[model samples]
Target: MIEVDCPSPAKPRVSITYCTQCQWLLRAGWMAQELLSTFRDELGEVALIPGTGGIFVIQCGADTIWDRTRDGGFPDVKTLKQRVRDRLAPERDLGHIDRP
Candidate 1:
């Protein structure tokens, strides 16, 4: 019998903080949905946090994965997924996203 290691239903939570003043709720919601759908098995929860001053940050626990204020740009879906995958399942392959 071949055994495979499947992702557990419970894992670290992810939070996305977006600027309410900047009207980034839709963008943040879209990213949250993408992350949740992609890593449904590996992730426990995805939270959307509203803020001000053009803040757009994505965090897994205390670690900051992406910050628009620091990175000077918003993260694309593939890039965000890759970062999440790196922390959650480093050994897993990301297929097309890994392609050059």
Candidate 2:
């Protein structure tokens, strides 16, 4: 029998890349803070990468969770939090976000 090792699911490392040319640091920082506070135990880390040309992207590993250009606008904190929670902890309920 060939034994194949599979890695267990660990806390996800989220990356939020925003445009430096557009001075989007404060916006990105707010998003990072929200994610950190909401997913304190579920996230490994949140990285803010500087870019140019009105770019803002959020990723979990190589998977793109949210993209500003693609999504059409900035994500609201509650919505963004739900996205992170869905990716990292699908079964974990986000109290207010999950509620109607």
Among these predictions, the greatest lDDT belongs to 1
Query: Least accurate stretch of 10 residues (summed lDDT) in model 1?
Result: 4-13
Cα lDDT computed for each candidate against the true fold = 0.90, 0.87
Q: How much is the lDDT of residue 15 in candidate 1?
A: 95
Cα error of candidate 1 at position 39, Å? 0.5
- Which 10 consecutive positions of candidate 2 have the poorest summed lDDT? 4-13
After aligning candidate 1 to the native by TM-score, how far in Å is the CA of 18 from where it should be? 0.4
Clashing pairs in 2: none
lDDT of 1 by residue, 1-100 (tens): 9996554456888999999999999999999999888888889888899999989999998889999978879999999999999999998888898888
lDDT of 2 by residue, 1-100 (tens): 9996443357678999999999999999999998989888988888899999889999988888899978889988888988888788889988878898
Question: Candidate 1 has what TM-score?
Answer: 0.87
Alpha-carbon runs more than 4 Å astray in model 2: 1-9
Model 1 misplacement above 4 A: 1-10
